[model samples]
Target chain A: MSTDLLTEDQREALQELVNIGMGQAGASIAQVLDEFVKLSIPRISSVAAANLSQEIVRLVGDADVSAIRQAFTTEFRGEAIVIYPEQSMAGLHEVMGYDADTKENKGEILLDIGNILVGACVGGIANLLGMLSAFSAPTLIADQTPAYRLLKPEHIQARVALLVEVYFVLEERDFRCHLIILMPETDILALGQALDRFVDGI
Target chain B: MPLSILVADDSSIARKMLIKALPAHWDITVAQAADGNQALAACRQGNVDVMFLDLTMPDLDGYGVLQAHRDEDLNGLVIVVSADIQEQAQVRVRELGAIAFIQKPVDAGKIERVLKEYGIQL
Candidate 1:
């Protein structure tokens, strides 16, 4: 798939969809944590599949981080990855009201957060686009590892990676995480078609 | 006089969708802004009678725009049009003097109802 899979209008439309999705995601997190979640304008970009690890590095840098991966399928097919720096993992316990003593406790909180974020965010976008998407159980991928190490090019068989960057921050706590929705090259065309239909309907 | 409306959002497609969702029979002149600064610029120029603002934007978010609108004492009535539907977000916008708040994927019927409820006749 070429980098020009989505035209300018389609890209803009998708970005708005991501924004709407992120907003819903933020609301869910705010409700769960009993705090306001500050939202940022979602950034959308596509890169060659082989260069995806580099892109992840660019976003989260080479810091030791923990990540959660959840897969969703429908017209939109991909994994939603949430990356948090290792140092911030402790703050999740205080924010989520979990005891920070046991590794199992930390992992449980991470999975729960991952599920809420991916299900709400991705589900929000899918809903806006009128697509029914199903989410797989979120899994804790790696802890205390660089993000790029988890998302190698060969691991993702897609020719093009559509990255929608949205970060979640709790106003009252020191909790923040970066969300990246990586769709395969084949699905890029499908997503483009879906976006065109959405634009046309408007 | 036609109602001078400004739709400020980073997405061109969202702006278009919002315009499409506006009541067709209302006599209105529309303006566009892609960020908070541009929205503020339009407000400063006295080009906005009713402003539809989005919360999460690039340079300046909608909250900053509303703060500036209050500080600068601009004459435009602001209705926040945003996807960020947190209860706190709504409260903050209202605190900043936005007249109303509308959710994203703009619905025409909702827009009409909001406008009517606010007694904004065009």
Candidate 2:
């Protein structure tokens, strides 16, 4: 699975698919928070699995990273990530209504938001693709490391990765964050035919 | 007169939603299964006429449940209610002899589509 493997048509199809997935995810998040959430332009690209973390780091730029990684299974197994700046964790905690005294509350808040955001994102993507995917519980890690290194795929034995990155902005608050999903190269290839079917039908 | 159906999914939210969305005239006797193995077992018992199965669950998952439905030569129409809506899911559901594959967060239109699949006019 080369980086340039997706053709113009496939690229367009995938872009639309990501757009739908993100929009749905945003809607669900909005419902959960009772606020309006906007999704930015989602960028979709591919890389070797070994380069996954590096590619993610490049896309995410330099930020103190707070991430939750969740793995999903089905015919195609991969990881879904909700990545945010360490700077914004407190704001996110506020938005999620977690004003607690215990230091452990922060970790709990991080995992809760991550789980909601990542699960909805993955579930929404699966819904649009007509794919069956089940998610594991989300794990939170607030590390000032590179995005890729912090949330790389381990369970999937694959050669390439398809990464979709999008920004979620909350209208009622100054909270905006990144949501990334990594699909195995083979999974994307399998989805390629599904995309073709959708495109053909349309 | 009514349909004998099995509704199986690990998510209580999902199962409850489907139960609430049932057509008023269905007059249905519903059996519920919280996971894949229970779904498979219920379908194998040969009591239900149709099963609304979820693909992702704790024990068996949807594929295994469908396989069991086939292995026992069971008689029932399967409608897959899943969040995984990829084309492969659709093809696989059809391959496993499902009458329809409906996406999650099921709404009235989706319910109508399933009904249409079952030869209901409206």
Top lDDT hit: 1
Candidate 2 regions exceeding 4 Å error are: A101-103, A141-148, A151-157, B1-122
Off by over 4 Å in 1: none
* Residue A29 error, candidate 2, Å: 1.9
Interface RMSD measured for model 1: 0.8
Per-residue accuracy of model 1 over B1-122 as CA lDDT, tens digit each: 89899999988998999999998899999999989999999999987889999988887989999999999999988999989999999999999999889999888888778788878865
Chain B TM-score of predicted candidate 1 relative to the true chain B? 0.95
Q: Give lDDT per model, in order.
A: 0.87, 0.70
Query: Judged by DockQ cut-offs, is candidate 1 incorrect, acceptable, medium or high?
Result: high
On a 0 to 100 scale, what is the lDDT of residue B13 in model 2? 45
Candidate 2 per-residue lDDT, tens place, B1-122, comes to 67787999775545766777777666678899989888877876878887888776655888888887887888888888865555555677789888898776567578767767778542
Model 2 per-residue lDDT tens digits across residues A41-126: 56777777777777767766666686777888765677777777665555565666767634577667657767776666666656
TM-score of each: 0.95, 0.56
| Cα lDDT tens digits for candidate 1, A19-54 | 888888888888988899888678889888888888
- Scored against the true structure, residue A26 in model 1 reaches a CA lDDT of 87
